[model samples]
Target: METPALEVQLQTLPSSPGVYQYYDKNQKILYVGKAKNLKKRVTSYFTKRHDSHRIGVMVKKIKEIKHIVVESETDALLLENNLIKKHQPRFNVMLKDDKTYPWICIKNERFPRVFPTRKLVKDGSEYYGPFTSFKTVNTLLDLIKGLYKLRTCNYDLSEEKIRNGKYKVCLEYHLGNCKGPCEAKQPEAEYNSNIEAIRQIVKGNFKESLQQFREQMKQHAEKMEFEDAQRIKNKIDVLENYQAKSTVVNPKITNVDVFSIVSDEGYGYVNFLQLSHGAIIRSHTIEMKKKLDETDEELLELAITEIRQRFSSKSKEIYVPFKVDAGEDVKVTIPKLGDKKKIVELSQRNAKYYRQERFKQMKIVDPDRHVKRIMAQMKEDLRLQVAPTHIECFDNSNIQGTNPVAACVVFKNGKPSKKDYRKFNIKTVEGPDDFASMEEVVFRRYKRLLNEGEDLPQLVIVDGGKGQLSSGVKALEALGLRGKIAIIGIAKRLEEIFYPGDSIPLYLDKKSETLKIIQQLRNEAHRFGITFHRNKRSKSALNTELEEISGIGEKTVIELLKQFRSVKRIKEASEKELAEVIGVSKAAIIYKYYKSKKET
Candidate 1:
């Protein structure tokens, strides 16, 4: 379906590193991509079939092709990222992060001021971070305040103003919170030294600060400045405590960025762990909605570039779970063992937890979306033609070949529909023939539904192995519903799922939602069947006791039992009480029978 203009454009595309933009008929941007070979990459889209339906549709909509030839692949990547953000293309990878994170800004002044800011002002000042939370910013600020006495006032502390005696020491100086930098009580070199330590601390590196503080304390202690040394010791304790919480791996794993991804059919989550001196200074997980069903490598590469730029990370090396194209400047390591691998695994775990949290929030905020996602997932996992919105599970229950019965529990939209539960008395099948009982109940359940013009379930789950499954399939085949409705069997021992003809069973993940629902269905059917079987046995016992009387018919026995409530109560009751309930002749037979049985 390529137009003549597009075909000609594709043929003439340069085999150079560049970024490409696909536009629709109205000059509306659809997608943005970067490639080392523009011609080969663009040509493959039109030449080969795309597995993703969305990708195929986007390709078909491309009425115009635009190219920006860059000097290198890195330049192409940067250009692609910029253009995608500028145009906000419809089919580009959509990063689901929009929060304005806080950054620590060091003011460019004679007396530099340090504070947290959400806005990034382009001046001569240095900004350390765009931290994910304000609490972390506050914690670092508190640590700095506790360690060093930096002026909190916004007054200009220029040399000219201090020389003119324009400012005086404030209450903060009185409280020892500031060294009166405004009034020049604190020397510029000393304040600047403290700022340097603060910079290192914000970068999650406390070694230099700790070493300096220990030396200062040693010098103070040798000079008999015991109070100052004690103060420095307290500062070291504070810094070490903070460092202990931040450090996650071996101290040798320093200045490394660990990036790991976990994805599903609809979205991908990439967790970035920023480590400095083996300490995790910052961690973030970004969710990206899939466009063109992009591979993990593609998503991870793009995310790493974007996140590093966003967080201003300058790490030369990164640890990943797989190989990626992060440009020539960056070294990528696929960790296979030891601490490197554990960090990657920790990143993946964070991504998984984030995904689970998002799912939980979605379920609460938008239940319809939640149900739709689960239904779609169930359809794919169970390999059904459509979602099993209405499912019925059958289980047979009997103890010692007595009161044999089968119970069918219904589930709609992955939840139990208790009202639709059906119980079948094993009439045709005798003894504990589970296979025959299953076949009979499966046939009877559907046969009645068909007879009554009621809708059938989209799926049928038989609670047993292949024997029970084969029997259920036979019933479906007899009712001409083999292919129309999907059926599966669940084995209790291994939790294996079996299909109609496939001898091999499908073992789902132990933690998978699909397997959980199947287990719920199986357990529910068993519980319902067991309860029915127990009740049936109790009733049969009750009927045998009274129905065995000489003149008591089933109806008379029922009437007497309904009046007395139990057989023991009937036996305890006087003849006058029984006559008042059943009748004089039947009451006399029942009372005399019980008396003779008691005497014997």
Candidate 2:
């Protein structure tokens, strides 16, 4: 169902290696593709049937066709990749790995300066990396600074300017940090040699620098200059130590880029490992969004070009999981065995791990996914058949056998359902019997739910150790719900979770989401119960004090409290103020009682 406009445009397409773009009715790019024969490739969409449903649907939506003729297939490939990244067409594989990473820049100047930068200036300067961390860049820079006496100032160290003595030596020169290159105190030949050594080190090559240092140390030792020899030996040790730490493969696998991709239905995670002199100095994972149902080969090919350009990778050979079209000039190897295969497998493992961590982070950041994950985790942790979408936690609050109360806090989907919370006065349990109080409250809660025909909670949590948990289990048994509901107890000290009929407790990891949710529930229940208990205790104490006043009846006490709110406020009130609240005679009695009590 190609439109008339698209058919005319397709007919005019040149028989050349180029990039083709498909557009919808509104002139929005639907897909970007590269082909050796642009005419044949663009026509195949209309002439042949696509097996992929996504491709079939995308073809039907095309309203116009656009193309850019290139000189070669390599040019088409690079152009297609750039277009995909820029426009992010609906039916193109788009690499979402555009995060700006730090790079070590070697500035192009009379006296070159080297520093870490996040931007690429395109000023004929060489950029080394898009390093995974600033710490790595800083460590390498520190190592270079220690081994080289380079200038730290930003002066225009031109030959004429240095000859004219336009700049003076700074504190860095006095501290032995710099060789005063700006004042021409250090020879350009010597400074250039240090720069060359730095370049070798940055490229993960230590042999040249180590050899020079070793030779210097030997000559110094032969001349009986032990201190200089020791200093050179220390420098060599530092270089070797750093090289050893960075090396992860055989020394023969030099100047090669390793790439491995792990893809899902929507996105692909591609891991890149840069090896120089058999050392993996750079490792990064790039995530790409799938526009069409692109195969791993297609996604990876696009990613290889994008990554190489972004990181300024100039490796002539690349070790990939599969053969990729990265131009005829670049050698692509699909390793079958040995260290190369091992490194490829390692890169694949890193991609897989990166994908898993990314999915986990997405779940945590997304509210719906977060709830679903937590609920599923809770179900598994508690050994429940179904996810605990609805959960209730009980805590008993009592102070020395008085004002006994229990609170139940509800959670729906790992979040507190505060409106569904319930509080119970300890009617059946007397004194400070926490176990009995827990039993009574659990029984009352589920019994009411059973009578009201309300849905039962998927899980029940008791905020205590085994004794309280056993008591709660007994209540469930009495209600014929011993096995119907999942119940567990959490201890205060270690946060151990105890199941009924099992003495052993389940200790979740400290950082586990399930443990955090359970802790939230337990803390909420305790807080709710304590708040209710405090209110009851305060009311009881207030009533008791009022009753201590002679001839002050319960009705009068109620009126005074209703008006004054508290005994302290009542005590602070004047006789006329109290009379306005209660009757004049009762107000006089209350005022005198508080005055005499204060005097005593």
Candidate 3:
């Protein structure tokens, strides 16, 4: 078999964590993205239909797949961010934030000052965070200040400065906010211990700070210093609340990856969440086409491997919705309780939402794929040997036992084919007999198709329950087509589907596409049948009115109707006007008959 040009490149993609870049034919970088498995992510661009027109266009313009494999997901994220900044790929999200995000800088100097700065200096200073917003930086700074008073001044509290007596106790010392470290009133070792505790808090470890505060609270209480004890108690409350909010999930459940899967008949969606210190650092969802009817476990295993490798996940543990073999080097946990389970559930919700979003996009972008999925689903739901690509639905229209008729609506590829629709005038069936009418119409429809060597429908639907279905089955049997073509009936009440020789009806889901199409077919048949029946009744009433006239036969009635169009118009016509359409002798009979009736 001849291989596609890009197939070789895609098939050889490294299933390891990496950052992939797409370039246009002109060698201009179009987009940059990070993946744990390069092959899976790159292949998705070619294999899956994107709901995003921009992404779709970008994919079409891609001339080459260039990737840089990394060691871990964090490395990939940093690499992707750096590449996006360096190259400014057209398809990447254009971040308008030129101003550097705030970071808590513990300045590298004597009596290091802890403060927020938008600039990073590689001067041996310990920087804690690059907060997304200034407010977050401020919150952390305020929390640190409240817990332990650090110096706000930029003065260097070195031994020479203290010996020279260059500085005195400041207002901060008087206010008890600082230990007066500028004037050597505070011991360096004691101040350094406080700095170490602050370092732990900034690193998102609150146990040390909380434990020290609890001991202080107990010491003050032992001394009967109630006010001091209560003050310490308040600080502990603030620390506890801050820690509670910061660790949204269990702090113990750190450095873990969560995976969940949601799927339909044709495609599967998988969501991956990368967490650090109980916080989600990265989230991604990918769409995968199911070629071999893979099970959930199989798809999830495949997704986990691809995503982990693409992102270069080094996390020893992972949380999943179900148990799966994720290599012997990694531990796969199906979280059943607490924060672990909740994260897994959250992953599932993300997968479901992604699937729903893709569905909406596919409906508008690739309607053919949507239709095919629906057809495949219906074929399975109906348990038919083949999809009902060409369907014929029969509905009998008999009102008050007059002008009984039936309509057969044709649906090709799940849509009404009005050109192939047919109407039947009940010939052999007696008045108001729906079963007999259905039998006559179904037999005539198939018998003529067979006689003319035309293709018969894949499925036949009668708009009724068991009785009407049996009638249709009998007609198909007489025509030697009982098992050749699949047939069923739908009843108006309760929207139930009935199969021939089956007592119980099959009730499909209310929101199922299969049921929706069936309902559309049944409704179309009824509408078409009713319309034909109304026209037949109206024509019959008009013809009968003229045929009742003395000496007026069927041919003469038709002749007058062909010209005057209605009985009222024929009655208003003069003998001369009537003669124009039916000749003199026939015109005289019609004219005389109406005139005598008016006189009476």
Candidate 4:
């Protein structure tokens, strides 16, 4: 970021309010900001003599800039919030938080009771707020409970007293907490009216509801109900305090979601903060990964696209990690001032924290400078005469006797090479024959490596015991690559490590770092292989019954399977529900056959 470049970007910006983006030399987003006057705001960063060290650092890294001119300052503010959330750039003040908004859920029942909740349920309950503060929401709930005398207990009074003939209403009525309509102590009409009034307050009708409460308070005082009047006044005060603290909304900016993406090396994290009518509502994070060799520009490009595909199409504006290369559907920019600036700065702070955490995990003071210790550990544990630059592990997957597959996952240094992962469909092995599958996969893999004249792996690992290890050795022997590549086998529990022709399994000391690294690699390979295998098996199971059904061709069977998960669920469905399934009709002869089988 330089003064001349800042001036150049500011000169081109529109006067309208929107988001702005500042990018570093590697084209990573350095900072995101929102501005009311884009030109005036962006230019401030260049001319300000008393800029803080954080801003100075950001300015140094900035090589490129971008902006989006939105409808109003409020839109700019919201878009800025979204971008900061998405990018988490490096020069902002972020609120220390994971606190989500709370909502008041009115249970769907004969006697509905309002409850405070963070998660919204789809079971016909009316959810409100997603209030800024949990304490405020709770206070309101308490006020409603005190004023209405509604049953706070979740237990069903009607079901308990009427249907089951259970216990009687006890203390709630005597203590004035509940109306006790369960035993007809209070009239249904009065209780229902109070419930409706509570609904009004939850719906944000504070002004009207306050007047009604005051009128009721006056009536209670006339009847010498001093305590009741005081309670009503307290409820009114709670509503006023909450309303005063909420952000004032500008009519133009009704709904907006802010996003920010921060990347360092090959890793990135996206933060999302949502606002409705200028009130902060929702927030989330998205983590990204790249190869250790990947550049900042390359990583940011992928991260922005991923964030857009996931969160942008549904949102009005897309705040990004850096200015996109162009041809994006939504506008992107960095904020220069106002509300959006605060959000962008916050995002930067979070990104800095995220990057720092990643650096700590890498542990090395200078990761670029390879240590001799790392190389030595790699050589001895893999049992290669030379240090292994690349390690490849293999595993076999199948369910009983079906959909067998083998996986080969590669690792560079100690991390996964996801791009080099390969899967083999077992063409020869039937049932859960791990040994045969290992042999076939090993032969096919190495045969290609040799034919292609590719660099041979210094080490090869198979996730199995002696039988699979022997199969791997035989495959390598057939290819004349047996001694060229060092092979090792990992066994579970008592049998830890095995190699072909070894008298006993080899167990590394528990305290060895080399063993820990190898175990991690082995677990990752097994996990990847098992996940693919199980998915294939499940698909096979779902296809089996459909394939065997007479009069059900592949197309019709595919349609039915897609609509219903299993044959059993489909059979249990009524004729009407069955007819609604694609390619199924009441008049179709196939329907009659399925119905006959269901009855039998």
Predictions in order: lDDT? 0.91, 0.88, 0.82, 0.68
Clashes of 4: 29
TM-score for each of the candidates: 0.89, 0.60, 0.50, 0.38
Put down candidate 3 lDDT per residue, 1-600, tens digits, no spaces: 213656777888899988899888799999887776888888888888754456677778888778999988657766776786689887764422244556788889888889998777899998865555678778878888887877888787789998899888788879888988778888888878888988877656677889999999999999999999999999999998887775367767777989999876667888988777656645678776654355687667667766775555788999998887676567889888988988999889998888788878888999888778877878878878787889999999888889999999999989999999999999997679989988999999999999999999989999988889999999999999989999999999899888878898899989777899999999999999999999899878866687777787888877877887878999999999999888899899989988998999
Question: In order, how many clashes per candidate?
Answer: 0, 0, 11, 29
Residues 445-528, candidate 1: write the lDDT tens digits: 999999999989999999999999999999999999989999999999999999988999999989888889999999999999
The 10 consecutive residues of candidate 4 with the worst lDDT sum are: 290-299
Candidate ranking under TM-score, highest first, comes to 1, 2, 3, 4
- In Å, residue 551's CA in model 4 sits off its true spot by 4.6
lDDT of 3 at 560: 77
lDDT of 2 by residue, 321-348 (tens): 8878988778999999999999999999
Q: Which model is ahead, 3 or 4, in terms of lDDT?
A: 3
lDDT tens per residue, model 4, 425-472: 999876788898999999999999888988888788898888889999
- Write out the backbone clash pairs for model 2: none
Ranking of all predicted structures according to lDDT, beginning with the best and ending with the worst = 1, 2, 3, 4
Give candidate 1's total backbone clashes: 0
